[model samples]
Target chain A: MSRPPYEPPAQSLTGQIVDALLVLAMVVVTLYLPLLLKLSGAGVTKAVQAAPTWESLGQNAVMAAQWEKLGFDPAKAAEIIGSRFDYSFSWGALALTALVIVGYFVVMLRWSDREYRDVIAERFGDDRPPRRR
Target chain B: MTDITPQNLAGVAAPAAEPVARRVALKRVLGPAHVWGLGVGIVLVGEFMGWNFAVGKGGAIAALTACWLAGILYTCVAMIDSEITSTVAAAGGQYAQAKHIIGPLAAFNVGLYLVMAYTMLEVSNAIVTGDLIEAFTHNMGLVGEVDKRAFMVLTIVFLAWLNYRGVLATLTLNLVITAIAFAAIVTLFLYVRPWAPGETLKHGDLLTGLPYGGLGILAAMHFGLWFYLGIEGTTQAAEEVRSPARALPLGTLTGVMTLLIAATITWYVGTGLMPWEYLGQAVTPLYDAARLTGSAPLEVFLFFGTLFATIASANGCINDASRAWFAMGRDRYMPVWFGAVHPRYHTPFRSIVFFVPIAILFAVSTPLDQTITLSILSGLLGYTLMALSVVIFRRKWPLGTIDRGYVHPLHPLPAILLLALCAVTYVAVFLGYGSQLLAMMAFFIVASLWFALHRYKYVRRGDQFTMRWPKPNGY
Candidate 1:
């Protein structure tokens, strides 16, 4: 019902560094959690592997069926599709690496800042802080 | 509202000034949900189309990685944008905020970029919508299929009509269509189950090789950018929203979270059901996902769903683009006619009208991928300026009782991070389209030249606003 007093908290350099580190840790966990699970023989890797492959990457069952129905070997058509689907995943790890770093910055800002938490409560919650009797 | 400008406050009797000041305005009818609808809706087309192209350039693994990175970048930017827009809720969105924090030149460039981004996106959606409709009808065995150009022209006109009607109509239409599009995605997840049925999924090892390698992911950045491209359009509704201080932040955060989830499902499950390469080439991607199930009616449902999604996105673009035009016109940054509102409709009728023909031209002439690239290019420019504005605001405005709605946490850190991501995106753009960057530079040069030529008119007439500390209470 009432707005909070406007006082931008002054975060010291050390406090800022601590917050940054905390955020970095969260980012590392989230960004790498899937890969870690895969490395640990979790089903996520299998599921990811099950995603449509480059060999058959561009051919749907219908397209393959259509090709087969047209008297062309479905395998040949799929191979052709695979060859054309050209984007390689060799540097995909780098993308994940980038994700980890960016994710760290985002999660850090969202979680580590005290003012942001209060602001969230004010915007989304009851818009009022508890009152003293 | 016009009284906020220095020209009126100084009682300038300039002959060029019209009595339409303050008289031409939009009514505040939007609430928090409307904001969410507009935010999510303007980007709904990205869910249905455009993103899959990245898969062709980068394999599934590379594309997925690029997509998530973009998602994180946008999430960070949106969080900061939420705070800034809430602090200064203006219809002009980033342009208005930039004017107060930076200066008129920054505001002018930012405004041009915002309008360019929204309108070009509108054109891209129109182009894609026309393609999807043609593909769907031809597949449906319809006797007479509509030509893509004619279809685009009609779609543009129809959307302009909806925008010309009013904000409430536009938002309501967007809400209904967005809900349907979201439901379609959920239904796709339920029915197709891309993650499951493992053996049926082929080419599983393709995730291991990045064909173009590390830099390929950067080339695919625009594709990832597609998922959440226009989410910032929500801020453009600040002047039309009821209690924007509470609603803008709530709406943007909610919308961004929802969009992130939607993007994840779209990238993972949609590609999982169909090969990413196929999705890359398909005109109607969601329709193809339905067709993969080998169900005729489901495909039809998704065809309509994709249509609805495109309409919602294109409609939102018209609404937001018109407002940006209106704001710029109000500031005398462009011709005053663009700022004029239809007294009857209380809408920026001229602004809405002007974009339709240009959008149709692009929709007819430009390739979908190129249109998308240009749209994202404008968006990156706008985002870069906005992120810079946040950094400037932090250094200038001492947080106090100055109607401060929300101050972003960690102060300059988020802004710095956003700027870094933006810099990386620019690098990716330059690397991908080395020659195209020159064209953008030329466009910017032309815009600056025009601004320089006209800067004195507003200054001489006291029509321009000067930058001040603390942004003078409210934007």
Candidate 2:
């Protein structure tokens, strides 16, 4: 059973608006998301100890207890597992990040396509009514 | 609309009087979406595994840089390949394209090399995925571990069955698997939002060391290529695509772009969470980072992502390898039974069936890194030929003379650059592989011997398949 030849439906105003918004969202995500993630100081970093002694660091009994369970000197453990951060962002990192974001969006758009359905329907040559969204 | 009649297909092998009749046929059910899915899905394992090996070779920074370099190189190949696929639109991917464009011997070599490459890749994926499943099960505290070899065989059989069902089922499964795997990456990216505030960036300096310097960077080249390694496989679906001219370029480029993003994020996030040395040695580095986060849910998410990615990649490889086998068989370069398609499923079922035991044998025997190198070796040979084919075909057809949908932009430059890059990478692969290079050489010799035997058989029969290719006018 052969179906009607595919006729690409007219783009509704809402559909067109959604498409425009998707494009806009993609642009924003690609250009700014990397900088935002970078500025947020969320990356691998070296340890920094604020406390002068194990007692000072382990004022909280829970912290002292946890360090003891791991079988390390409280002072040494404090230094080893201290508050860590990385705020540095290089130009190269930023460029790579942006490239990734853009690539993600491009792939996403292609992966979720109606054209595959159209092609399959045509090849199967079915006469079923148009699928309801 | 493009014609589906066998008479219109320039090089499809069948009896001369009944060119359209065959034991089985491919159903043309793919469009741009499915094409993109196949392109990205087949190669997604690179994102999930293997790439971190580059970190050991050249440190994180240099490895990342190498990836970008390879990305640009593949972008060129993808564009030129898209143009050729659209114009030729044959079933055997690069093999079919090369058959008409570069002649029969070249086609045989290209097709055989591609089959080897995809089979190696699929075998590697099966083994790795089996190990991953066991590890993930342990991580999740699931009971009773299965033997890795048994699991590997099961993975190959399952994916082969999916492919044997038909093209639509295979592509549909690919789309789902790729989507889930990609979603997991997105989840990781969102999780790794803020840079840690106080830790020293020791790895930044690690990038400059390059371990053994130039040799180390060269050693890292194949792992870098992993980022965008199998995007060219998209062309294998040309016979099934509704409009290869329109879909090939859109799908291939889009797929390449998607991989670029996945590779960059996977690298940045994985390295950012842990030191390069630690990340490089771990079996699944990304999942290791999730564990470091100490978030159980995040760990589970990344684990599922790894699992799905492996499935998608292996499944796609099975589809690609079988098609190459089918093409070779149809051309009578191999046993005719391998060319038989299923009557109802419209698939190259016999080829799929034949491929399984061989893939299982490979998966059970080879170690992971060696399997990876073998795949890369065959891939480099195919890539070299494909880039060369771009130049030869362009010169022979000269754009206007042929009915083509996509014309490569900045014609000849991409082809030239691809040739040079592939030459450099080939040297890099050779320098890196040491003893494994000898094994690859041995494999090449074996392939050559097989080709010689095949040629002899064809000559003796006097009903040579190679002689029948109708020469295009003005070439």
Candidate 3:
């Protein structure tokens, strides 16, 4: 029946988080795609295996054999990725994330504003407050 | 007797019988997206780090199949958690939710179960990380062998330092780890000409006279349960999340689904590429697979990815587990001082300070397999209780909770079924390691004692709460 003595307010961040996710998405796409697919056809997987140190290692001796057949060359892949359409996707993704984050905060701002009606009514106005869920 | 009361005489209808007399504002932290990432990042990484080879290369077929099945059950658990959490949304994860619906003793036991379960997880992650570091170093011909205990201590110390910065810091670190883990998994899927499930199974299960025998499937599933341990972290953080009415469900579902798919594919492909015989024999299967599949650099990347994942697991656990103390301390269920948060960082400083050091000690002093076995067993105990809570709380309807999210369509059936699976795994654990009986029994005794002591404290505090609540006798 008794309310606890006090409850602390939840922590809020000054900087929005959704934007960070968007940036990560852009970064991963840029960095990951090239690493994954090699143009001369040796992908990042192959490149890692072919280096002399890896080729000479145990079991890697055989792994290197498979890497070559996969048609991966890291150098060529890098060139292709560098030449690819300048990060239109990154720009758009960030824009979209910004829009969504801003919209979410705006909605929450309005909801909290409704709660303040109680404070407003208790002190001055005749506004009836909304019932709590 | 009319539908009007003194307050409602002015044409205002009497308020419908309020289910709960107490109304509290649930805390708001991050949105569902970040919360989901934190929960998923916590469990997904360490399991991803360790199990990749077990499922991906060696027992790809069996391991992936186990993960898929486990993933389904995991989703069911998450859905059930979502339903319960939408209503409870308290700080204590499974412990509080179950306690309110069941009773203090039950909640206390749930907390105890989780403490052990998560502790096991910490040890397992440390051990796996130690193994990886050892393998990397040995292969590089740097050291003949790495001591597990030394590394465990290192891991604990490192994680403690990270967590000391507080929850926000851990959450940020978790995000980074989650992203890297996903990227690494996606890269594997994209680059590797992944093998078909059936083929991979046939190829990976190279261990003759294995795959389907007396409890091998059950044995592996028991361990594989690690991948799904912290799904409830989202639910526990329900009150803290922004708009938990929505975030709670979204975080639970998204986090589970994301981890499930990646885990499944990684398991399947890793298994298919490597001969199961070779995989079973190797020290750390996934790392071996990475080296075998690509080059030294990819192998190196796999190492880094796993390291990040383990760090994140420890980091996230430190963040979430510490909150238990904050809740307990704040409410006087435990010592009051533990409720103290760091002034500058706004974190559960003491709990964070406490968690990693003990975990690190276990990792360093205990044997790897022993630590792992304990971790999975303890986690299963918590999970089993949560699944059971779904059934119990739903049956007890008058506790004043409203669920505003999607309930699992099958309702009670999924939770019940999951409990059955949990039972099977529970028995399997006993079979896998009979020595674990001593550990399990010891933990049970300790829990019972703690439960009695906590109830004693509750009564002594004149807390205004009575025993036998939600039941026939009201103390």
Candidate 4:
């Protein structure tokens, strides 16, 4: 059998404009919300501050002195040097994580299975074998 | 079922006597060893440097736990990837699988993930190469300050040139250098002589309880990814392999096993020689361990090992990342201009050259850890999608509907386990790099929107499902 011709779905200019605007809004919210609420943690800040000295050059004194040589603020280097990992565990975080995982698995399976069956039916007639146990 | 040939599977006509620009395909010359090299070459660099960061996060014991946990996660990844890629037998690896198994939007995102992950990794490797050279020159008391940027650019240029010339030569070079790097690790393990009395390793003095506790072990899982980050990259060469059925799975499984052994030895030697505090933060833990041995010859061998591992990683990154971009281009997900293969070389010349400056730019400008985090996050997203895609693949194309190169044991279980592990790793990343995580999500979301509104029109969507197969189940 010969291949079938395909036509792309219609996309309106207004719809495209709306999508662009929505994407912009999402990017803004996802990036700025944490900083706006001060929910951002020591992770990235500590990484930037600590990496040049602590990661590249060993020894706290040498790292601090390198910062001094570069004419950066001494307090910033000191804070970075003293940084430590937060070992506390939150049960709420764990619960939410579990919720997201289960929710995603269920949603993906349902949607993808539905969409896949539709694709097969469209491409290759509606004949299907019986389900196996 | 009808027998499948590359021409029939790809649904393309054979090339004419003279090379035709539009019809050229990637050369199929690779074997199991090249596949193994591509997988392991991309990841062995992790053993040299970034894995040590796990020690910093949770101490030695926590790091070891993270290693085992991440190993299980990647084993699931390898099995799932081998099965899917062996059947798909196309460039773009997981991207191609997503296109055929799921849909276009997923394919686009998976392709982007592959490109971003490998490109960022290439940048990191280049920067490490330059830094290693500068440090070497300084230690040798060279006459002048060595500029690392020049070496970084040169590394990218040389590798890109090699890739542009041919696939066989590029991966053959990778196989050689990757083996040497692996041998270096074994040599170090033998030199330390852990089995002999009064061995060099001082594990009794050095082993410590998890300094950060159990939560720290969870946190360390993110860095633990460094142990085998790019092994899934083996499948990127699926289309080029001589026999995708036998070679892909063999190469991928063996690659993971190699990493597991290498990771264990690296941890043992490192923690045995250095204090947990120092081992955790040391830039080159293995090299430093060699320094502790006070063997100049051993130190120099490891220095070359670190250097070669970094180079091999960058080389493989260029290969995988370009294949992804080229595959996307072939489908017009990106511009068709990048789809062109060099008529004689049979390489994706445009895609290979396209990423050269981008890698160099990021290498010079971006902070090392930031790039590393973004690469890992991109990889995690790809794995999550892979887990979901495999389930969809099995349900739609159940066992008897079509031929499969390999079938993963206990279907659905690996998928579910992969999903769970990916979720835990996502949480692990969020606990530490929450801002970067959010930022990466935003970037991909925007890119998806762009593809939907702007790029989708150019893609001949129906042509993407070219692979000949029996009707999917439940049709």
Candidate 5:
């Protein structure tokens, strides 16, 4: 049997123009929408202000100088550092998260088992032979 | 074998020359190592920089918890992707799988997701590369004020040219740099000697309880995605791999394992060296940790590590994004002109070149965090779709119906877990980035509408099914 010749669909100039404009609009929205939404607030200044200084660097000026030489702001590099984890527990949120995990697992197991068995039965008849493996 | 050339065939009539056009395909020269390179190269940059943001949101313990949770999510992703990609064996990765299992609109959306995710990541990488160089020159007192845009444009151009040349050379380069970046993380881990405790790492003083309680861990899952963001990209090279069935699963599974190890070491080293507050907000936490050691050689090693990881990531992004865009073009989901494979180089040259300007433009103008966030959201959406697609795939073409190189154990469990994890991750992201999440959804909805209304006319529906599989069961 002979196959038909392959010819791509013809696109009109107006159609092409519309595609180009549509693509351009998508690009614009992708690039600028996040910025307009104020998602870029995690800027450098906030990072510098929020960063805590290492206690070891405070006693050693030479090390601190090296850190500054590496482009970190020296003024922002002064503080006593310690473990900030205070074990403040949010029991409600924690319990909720745990419940979601356990509940989803049970639900998925039941649903998936039924669906998988159907597939198995469909592919191989109910009187299928035993596996060679 | 008989040699029946024109000269050898004395009386036999020559076969009639067909009028059909010749089909050009991507070269199949990649091995498992190249597959590993492509997967790891795109992700090792997370070890260098971004993952630490999780610590800022949820503290050290929370960050670690998020790391494990995200690990599970990507583990399911790797398994599901490996199984389906090994069967489909096409260039668009999830997009290709979606097209085969699901319908056109779903496939179209998945294609857009892949393109957007990798392209945005490429832009973020280029911007980071330029910023790293600028910071380096300034620290050395060699240059006063550097124009980062020049370096950003140069990085994109160089990578695009590399991608335009050939797949083998580009991935071989990725393998070398990715290995070095991975080694740097290992070296830092060894240098700290966590086993010896107080000699270097002060974990006793540094290891604290969860700062913001349990909810903080959920929040941290959003940034924890950085640890293994683009690992699923290994499947994007499916069409180019020499042995898609064996190589795809092997590379992807191993790649995920490697990321899990690296993420753990990165978290341990980072939290031990500095306070969680500082580590969370750090632009380059690993480099900052190296400097805290007061060792100049270690500092230099980490500096170069960060630079090389960034470059390698951008390189891998170019390869994956171009492949997805090229596949879409081949199916006429977009203009067919981008479907052209280079006759000499045997690459998606037009698609490779198409992204250079887009990457450069966004690299210079877009905020780094915004681009990263968008990329992550797109990737999460793709993962969610992948979970659904795999279930559909198994039901439509059950076991033994088609050739599967690697069948993931516990059918449908991975798919289900992937969905659950995706839902949790979405909630995590929404807690912090609700507005950006909504806006991105709007953007994809609009793009989907455009695909349905205008783009479908250009796509020849029947011709898009280029695979050699039999008609799907019950279809």
Candidate 6:
């Protein structure tokens, strides 16, 4: 079936703002929720997969135990989860993500003004022409 | 929006210099996000060995040194490519632009080199993922062992099927994969926070010598190089992006720096606790880390993350390789069938279909190490050509003509130095790829022979693919 064109609502600016704000809030939650869940619990589904049978899940659990010997701590019992099964590893990982995100944001914002790179670029002469194909 | 008519894009091949009336889709050139996707994808496949190598055999100092060196090399390449990107954001990207300077043969070579490189990358990625999957399976107690050959076939079939849907499908795949993989990294990061407390500020130097006399900084460089592989991939997506002139350079920088920082942090925390040997031996080190953290959720996250890394990378390979092939076909170098876009997908579906089986066969047959070494060789070779091409293109058109208008700063130095350093790095990495140089030599021979046969065919048809290309003893 041919798809119909998307039509924007003929509404006031309020509608757009409301929609955008909703999206923004959703973004923040999505960004941090996964981290929070990971640090807090060990029962969360990993990700979307070709849904496996219960048998497969059960088998995987047995295998997960073997892995614990190799280094995988299901309850994060060793280090990440200091409590009986406290999962702090998940939180530490969150901190790491924050570092990367901040670094990326800072670099991008600084470069956006196109000022900082000028000194290095200036060495190349005024050959810096704005080209649009 | 105007609907696409049958008349638009009617011919599979159009004039190389201009887009046919309907062929030009009004979209933005690639943004930083696309570039990051491509780079990450390429690295995921292209530099699997380096990642493992740093963890396993390389010394702490070696790995650290490599990271710094890679950072410098990547920065230079980014600066150099930005100029070419600005000039030809609308031209045939690297292909058309290079043809203008070096002529048709070299142009054909560039496209062909790209195809070969991406194909190798996909196979390499599958092989790496296979290794990771094997570990995951063993951890799950699902099997006695995982056979690489079987895994290769599975990975190839899955990737081909996924890519058969085209660019959006692939992009969707890339985004999902990146998100999951990022999550895994986050999990590992969190686990390291309460690490052997009170030892945080002890190490004065980042490049501390490895315990038990390890590989030192070489391992770090290897991983660094691996991580930086696809940083400039956004250039190829110029035809589909929005305001690439503003986006490409900045995006390239953003994407690479993100991975760079991630690798650096991961290395610091990861190696700090686990022995490099233990880390190296792990089929899935991140997963191992997750397991060690004693978190069931993190374990699953790591497993799924590896899956995403592999799948997203495969999608990226398909998208990038197909586009280059399409360009080649349109230019009369490859079969015209490679140029045809799917009506529904608006993708070079035929090219991707052709590409997948080849990758599958190689992935299934070649040893994972061999596949990895060859992929790096292939990618580095293409990058070397691109670096050189940038220099030549700049020199040929010093007074760069402005259409929509974007330009580079200097003509000779940036391009010249980039090519020089790229040449040195390319050769060094090539040597670094294998214990024996014999296989590397053999691949070169194969590439050379293929070029020769193509040249002979071109001559017979009285249509030299190198009509304008520089003939360095028919190189």
Q: Give interface RMSD (Å), model 3.
A: 22.7
What are the Cα lDDT values of the candidates? Answer: 0.66, 0.66, 0.53, 0.76, 0.74, 0.51
CAPRI verdict (incorrect, acceptable, medium, high) for model 3: incorrect
How good is chain A of candidate 4, measured by TM-score? 0.59
Give the number of the best model, judged by DockQ.
Answer: 4
Give the residue spans of candidate 4 off by over 4 A: A1-4, A7-81, A86-133, B1-23, B196-199
lDDT of 3 by residue, B1-475 (tens): 1121112211212232212223222235568777877788777764455453223211335555567667877877788877766655566667656545554455555665555556556666777778878878876678466775577678877877776765555676788777886776676665565545432233323323333343445545655665677777776565456566578788778888788777766665555555443443234555665666646777777778777777777766666666764555544444445556676666667666655655755566555445555666566666666676676666655223333344556777888878877766654444334335334544444444543543224322212121112221111
Residue B246 displacement (Å), model 4: 0.5
Taking all chains together, each candidate's TM-score versus the true structure is 0.75, 0.73, 0.68, 0.82, 0.82, 0.66
Model 5 stretches astray by more than 4 angstroms: A1-9, A36-133, B1-22
Cα lDDT, model 2, residue A133: 15
Q: What DockQ does every candidate get?
A: 0.02, 0.01, 0.01, 0.15, 0.10, 0.02
For candidate 5, the per-residue lDDT at B446 reads: 74
Stretches of model 2 off by over 4 angstroms after superposition: A1-133, B1-7, B10-24, B194-208, B459-475
Q: Which lDDT value does model 5 have at B433?
A: 61
lDDT of 6 by residue, B329-429 (tens): 54445544455667766666676777666677667655554444445545555555566666655444444232313455665566566556554443333
State each model's TM-score restricted to chain B.
0.91, 0.91, 0.83, 0.94, 0.93, 0.80
Lowest summed lDDT window (length 10), candidate 2 chain B: B459-468
Please give the C-alpha DockQ score of model 4.
0.15
Model 2: how far residue B474 lies from native, Å: 7.6
Best by lDDT: 4
Q: Summarize candidate 1's per-residue lDDT along B1-475 as a digit string, tens digits.
A: 2233322221223232122224345677789999999999998788888888677666667778878888878877787888778766666888777655555566666777787788878988888788888878877789985888888888899989988987788889899989998888888767765556553333452233565678667767757788899999999998788777788888888888998888877776665555444555555677776766677877887887888888999999999988987888766666555678787777889889877766776678666766676678788877776776776576655666244566667867777777887867765655444334434544654555555553324421222322212222211
